[model samples]
Every structure is written in C-alpha cells, then in structure tokens.
Target: MEYIDLYLIHWPMTVKPGKYEFPFPKDEIEPFDMKSVWEAMEECLRLGLTKAIGVSNFSSKKLHALLSTAQIPPSVNQVEVNPLWQQRKLRELCVAKGIQICAWSPLGARGALWGSDGVMECAVLMEIAEAKGKTLAQICLRWVYEQGDVVLVKSFNEKRMMENLDILGWELSDEDNHKISQIPQCKGYQGLDFVSPSGLTNPSWSFGMVRFDSIIVERERLQRTVGLIEPIVDSAVIPSGIVISSIYLKYKKMGRIPEVLLISAAPDSKPMPMIGFGTATYPFGPSEAARSAVVRAVAAGYRHFDTAAVYGSETSLGEAVADAVESGLVGSRDELFITSKLWCSDAHSDRVIPALRKTLQNLQMEYIDLYLIHWPIIRNFALDREIPPAVNQVEVNPLWQQKKLREFCVEKGIKICAYSPLGAKGTVWGNDRVMECEVLKEIAQAKGKTLAQICLRWVHEQGDCVLVKSYNDQRMKENLEIFDWELSEEDKYKINQIPQQRSVPAEDFISDVGPFKSLMELWDGEI
Candidate 1:
C-alpha cells in the first residue's frame, strides 16, 4: 500500500467478441471478461500492490458489471473525459458511488482519435492560465481534481511528469468551474459500439473511424486563430486546386481571408503546374538587400514569409511583414503563412521555449505558423577551420535529437518546417555515395521527375512543410511542381534503395562552438 498511491489496469487485454483474432486467424480465441480482471485487481489490493486500485478505460456498463461481481468495489475508474467528450454521466455515477474518477486522456490522445477538439485549447482556459501564469494542462488538471477526482495525467518525460504533479497549490474559482462545466460536450471518439454487427462489418474498423464531428468542432475552436482575415468572395476562387492567376489577384483573394493559397505560375489554372517563386529566406546575415528582395517578392504577390533567428534577418523580415499588413498587401498576419527555423544552438530540450521566444521577439510576432531546426546536429560543435581535430570532434545526431524537438513543437501546435531538407547544398547532393546511388535517378527517370523533385516529394510525404531553396527561377518552379505528380510504390522503392550518406561533410565544422558540427549533423535524421 505504501509503495503505490494508485494502481490502474490500463486496458482490457481481451479484444471485443468480433474484434478478437489470434495469430493470423488460425488460433482465434474468445473474448475474456472484465469480471476476471476485476477479480485479479481485488487480489492485488488485498496483497497491497496499491493503496488504491482502479480500472482504466472502463465503460459505464462494464463498471456496473464489475461492481455486481466484485467482493471489493473499485476505488476509482479511469476513462477519457475531455471537453469534447465530457463523460458526465460516468463521472456523476462514480461521484455518487464514492468512486474516484481519473481522466486518462483529458487532453485527447492521437489526432486520428481525438480530432483536437477539447477544453484544452478553450479561450476561457487560456485566459485563466494567462491570468494565473500557468499552463492549460495545469489548469485542466486542477479542474479535474477540484471535482473531487484524482487526475491521471501521463507523460514519458520526467520534466512533464513533474509538471503534471505541480498543480496542487493553485485553485480555480467557482465561476471558472461553472464556465468550464458549461462548455458544450462534443464527441471526439466514436465507434464505441465496435462490437455491433454493423461496426464489425465496416472496412473502416481496421483503421478506426475518426469522428469528423469533433474535427469540425476543433476547427471551429481554432477558427479565431485565422479570424482576423476577411474571406474572399470571388466565385472563381476554388477551395482546393492549383491557383493560376496573377500574383495580385491571388493575394487579393487569399490576403483578405484566413485560408491557405495554392499558387502556381502557369497560364492555365490546371492541376499540377509549376510554382514560379517559392518562399525564400536570406540566412547567415542581416542585409537590406535581403529585405528589398523580400519586398520585391511580396510586391509580386508571394504570401508565404520565411525567416530565422540564426540568419539575423528576422528583424527586417518582421518589419517587412508588419509593413505588408499595414499596407493592405496582406489583410492580417493570419493571412500570411510565416515560417522560421530554430537554430542548432537552440535545439536543446530546455532551450526550445526560450529560443522560440527570442525568435518571436526578433520577428515582433505573436506566434510563428511553422518553425524548423536549421540543422540536425544533436550536440554543440564548432565551425572554425583552424581548430585542432582533437577539440573539434563532437557528437552530432543522437537518434533522439529531432524526435524530441518535433514532439515539443507538435504538442504546442507549431508546424514543423524542414529547411535545407536535402541537407545543405553540397552535403546532400555532393556526396559520392548519394550521387552514385542510381535509385533516386532511376525513379526520377521512370516518373519523368527531377532527382530533386523526388527528394522534395519524399520529404513532403513525411507531413512537414518542405522548404526547397534555389536561385534559379526554373529550378524553383520545378521544385514547386512536386504536388502535381504522386510517386508510385516502385519509384519510392527505387529511391529507398539508396543508402544514407551526409552530403555536407560534418568534419568541416566539428569545433564545438555552435549548436551543430555542420549542416550535415543538423539533418542527420530522415524526415
């Protein structure tokens, strides 16, 4: 009892009746009953495996059945109870029966299941957190506990776990609780009756049918994020497809609204056309020349703005973005798709937030639409040529590097934008191993696509906002034409045959003075 504050049976090991299938369907087994599991929990409590024992993810009917059979009733029942799917009745029953309710996925689980709608991102919650100087998670947990239930928040990270437990001292006002309770319940998880014949027979059962209702609700919640921009009313503008129009008309349509604009440079607004001018950023130094170039691009109707802190051009870019907004070129900041990169120096887990703050300050923006790791190096390394080899060599990409950064960004709702995607200019394409590998080229030839297009397409497939840089307009247009053609399985297999090799040499910059050894180390992980 002293060893554990609480013990929870995560999920029923047995699949639903129709859902159960054993090893290639040859060794099928019947579904096991939760009554047996509850019996086991009773034994554990008697033996002192926990001070309090409970069942997680149990339905109301399941709980009642368990109660009817158990010698000792469960102290708690853990289940998903976010704003979208409040599980109010279950919570009320647990309260009435003297059973504590622990919310398992209070913030929603995977995107496919939860669809992002919840009290987690509610304006009221955010306002409360801002007033109290706490996080939304902290506020949500406090709400859960205030209702006389133990909140079962989980995180693999030690820091996050510790943060989850730090919500005890703060209390919410009665008014706050009432407002939170008033939030309309929306369903995030559907197909709860998976055992029903119709559900079992559906093909979507294999992948789980995501509740689109919740997705629409979540989109409505975040609609304010893009609310500032006015909608374009032209009958010619379609929601999705290649946008073929003068840069001015495209800007006039998209700039007035809170929507994504798919721009291309083709005369005919046909599908799969080339993009004339892709988003560009002048990294490495601050130059008025670069600002002028951006101004020119904006004047030519480019809606996407890309910048970074390490490049020192964010200040100028910010000024340009502000000017663009003020000049009516873009109706609001939300109308523009702004992307920036987090430098290698700021890739440390602890440094992520502060680094983003600095970027925001420099850019004079509230939030960035997308942020990328400039390079993929895991440890601090130098870029000086004169440094001796003994002092220069440092660890580069540790498998966990990009994964940690990506998780942090994903949780925060910041899009991950991959830059120098093929590894800096020389490193990715220059390597003999990479160049000699005929698979990518073969795929390109087979699909009548450029080798660079194959690389960009592969990166795009990974769910990142891909940034491909080119000085030549033709190359830029060719790079932008990627969305038109889909690479076949054979093409992907041919490209996969090529072995991994660093295009930019890490040894050239392994001095341990900056965030990365070289550009190669920055892109060590595949997208």
Candidate 2:
C-alpha cells in the first residue's frame, strides 16, 4: 500500500476491434487482459504495494464489467486531461461511483498523438499566472488538483518532475478557476475516431476547425523553401542587403547614434524598443542568399546579429558574427550585439538556463547581448504536420510574465530584444488592419510616414532597441526610418488604443514543432 498513491490498471482490455495492441503498442506491451490486470491490482493492494488502486485509460464499459466481478472494486480512474480531451464522461462516472479520478497528461504530452490546438494558451491562465508570478503550467496543474482529484504528471526530466511536485502549495481564485473551466474543449485524439464503425468522422473538436489540408500546403511550401536553402548554407544566416543600411546612414545624419534597434513591444518593456544588432531581418536560417545578405550588411557597417535556439541556424550566424569580429568588421563582441530567443519548450525556469547555455555554445559566444521571448502564448499540440487542431491553445506565459527573466538578464547586462513588435503581421491586426487602423493611419498621415514606418516608430518609441524585418532593401530602409520622426502623444495614444488581437490562431498551425508558445514566452523579462 505504500508504493502507490493509487494503483492503476493501464488500459482497456482491447483496443479498437481489429487492432491487436493496447494503448500505444509500439511503446507499450500488447496482448493485455483486463481481468488479470484487475486481479493483480487487487493483490497489490492486499500485499500493501499501494494505498489505493485505479484503472487508467479505461472506458465505462470496461469499468462496469470489472466492478461486476471484482472482490474489491477499483478505487480510482485515471484519464488524459487538459482543455482538449477533457474526459468529462469518465470523470463523471468516477465521481458517481465514489472512485477518485486521477487526471493524467495535465499539460498535454509532446508530439502529435495529442491534438494540436492552442487551448492551453488561454488568456485566463496567462492572466492568472502573470498576477500570481507563477507559470501557466503551475496554474493549470493546480486547477486540475482543485477539481477534487489526484493529478498525475509524468516528466522523465528531473527538473520537470520537481517542478511538477512544486505545484502543491498554490491556490487559484474562483474567477480564475471559472475561466479555466470555461476554456472551450477541443478534440485532440483522432486515432480512436478512426476505430469507430463510422470509418470516417468529422473532426469537430473545438478551438475552431482546422483545414489540415491547407496547413499541409503551406507547410509543404515552407519545407520546400527550407530545403532549397539548406544545401547552400551550413546554418541560419541573415542576408546583408536585406538590412536597412540607408536608415543607419540617415540616423547618423540626424546626429543620433542609434545604438540599439528594438524589435517590438511587449508587456514588460512596454513603450520601449528592445536592444539588438541594428534592425533585424526575418526567416532566420541557413541560406546562401541570407549569408550574402549578412555579409553585405557587415560590409555596409552593420554590427548586430540576432537568432534563436530553435532557428537551427545559430552556428552559421555565429560564424558570420565571429568572422565579422576577426576581420575587424566589428571591434569586439561588446561592440556587436548578438541576440537570440529561448524556445518555449525550454521556458520552464529549470530548462531556461540550460537552453540558453546550449544556444550560447552553439553560437560559439560566451553570452548573448539580447534574448527575447518569441511570442507570449504557448501552443499545445503535437509536432505533426498532418494533424488537425494542430496547436494546443495554451497561454503558457501571460503578458508581464517575464519579470524574473528580465531582471536576470539585466543583472547580467544582457539587452532584451522583442520580436513580433506589432503582434506579428499574420497575427493580431493583419496587413489590412495594420494599414487601415484609423488611429495608426491617422498617425501615419500626420507624420507623413508609411504604415510600416509608423509601426516601427511605435516600437522604437518604446525605448528598447527595435528590430524590423524586410527582405526588400527599400522596405528595410523604410522600417529603419522610424527614428527620423517621433509619434506625438496623441499618436501614441491612438496606437495604444488598438485592441489586442492575435493574427496567428494556434489552431491554424501545428504546435510543439517549435520552441516557445506564442512568440511572447521566449522573451526574458527585458521585454
């Protein structure tokens, strides 16, 4: 009885009719019999192997049959949970039977077997975690515990296991709990659906319907593009001409040193641009074109470089940075700013440091000048391109969530750079809204600036260095011209008035394939 907080019957006796294996046979053993499993569980309890015994992944039919023949009825039932796959019926059945329900996979598991949707990126969870100075995962786990059940979280990593245990002491507000419960449920598992006699079933799981076919098309396009670039370069590289040297020249003419070019605005570093290698470019990774562009940027006298751990091109970028320094293109690392973002998969405090260290090692640098959160939301989904509801919509980190990280970086004097300054072009406020937002347009009109200029200026005005990307030299120059004009108080106010909106809904894309949840989680507190 001492070995287990609860004993578990691992799965139902049979998988979908024709399937011989049970519960992921590639990893778990097959030829399982529920009757024998239940009897063994009973013996374990009688032999003091556990204080309680439970059945895991069991259906109502199986549990009913088991109870009909058992000398000692099961004391608990465990099932997958998280907003997607809420397992409501199983939970209710256990409740009615006085059998405790132990929730498993509270945070959703990695890879695609779990559905992909950004449900976990709930605004409520982010908000609460932000207020409490806790992680969204902690808040989520606590929510599960508050539901009056034993929560089982599995993490082979020592740090994660400890972090899981650390959740016992916190309490969630009723309002927060209510908000969590209200999170729209989305279906994540489709393997079972295929097993049904229906042969074909509509994947109507929530978080909005995903056109997996469309995503596949887009992903294929991206993969093709990546493949085209992969053979030409060894790592992620930024093209030189792509950077706005004209803007640097213009700023010099204005008697402004333009020491930093902030990428975007985030909660902590609000109203200030973040620090970085002057005006950044996007689609960071290995490419001859990108390398040529970076070389040109270096030749043209640009000195800063930015990349992230997950970009898979830091080595190339690092090589460029080092070459620039060695050739006296930049006097020293201090003279050249290098920035990278921590991936969301490494957002946990324990994981954060190691990830950063690995990134640094890969870049062949002692430390980075700036590190940022790629996005503010965490996508809860599997890492597959074919799956629907591809991202688990989870708010792994809320706005104002990087305070600790910010302080840490600042303490180390590492400047923070924020990406997706205007909430991502594809995300909140699409190109149309960005171009037509009454306030922004008015500001642009008043300042005689283009929409992109106004957007970049808004980020620049925030104080930290700002980074804006454009493959076209003219557009890059335009994005950098932001320093030439300042937003008026009214203009600033108007820009601020635009309601918060995310253009990239997690459901539309696959999750867990990249690091960090929405771009926000990657930023260390510097925002």
Maximum-TM-score candidate = 1
Worst 10 residues of 1 by lDDT: 390-399
Query: What tens-digit string does per-residue lDDT give for candidate 1 at 1-527?
Result: 25687787765334434753332231232234567777887777888877878887665555676677778887878776665456665765687778888775666654444345445666667877888898887888887777676666768889888888988887888767655654434444432222222122222222211212111111111221221223233322323342322112111222111121122212211111111222334336666666655555444444456666766878877877777655544434544556566776786899999999998998788977555555532122223223111111111111112344444333333333444454443532233443334676677777788777777677554333455545454564465556435677776555555544434354544457954555545434332
Report the lDDT tens digits of candidate 2 across residue range 311-348: 67677677776665554343344444566777768878
What are the Cα lDDT values of the candidates?
A: 0.51, 0.50
RMSD of each: 21.2, 22.8
Give me the displacement of residue 248 in model 1, in angstroms. Answer: 11
Compute each candidate's TM-score over C-alphas: 0.37, 0.37
Question: How much is the lDDT of residue 128 in candidate 2?
Answer: 82
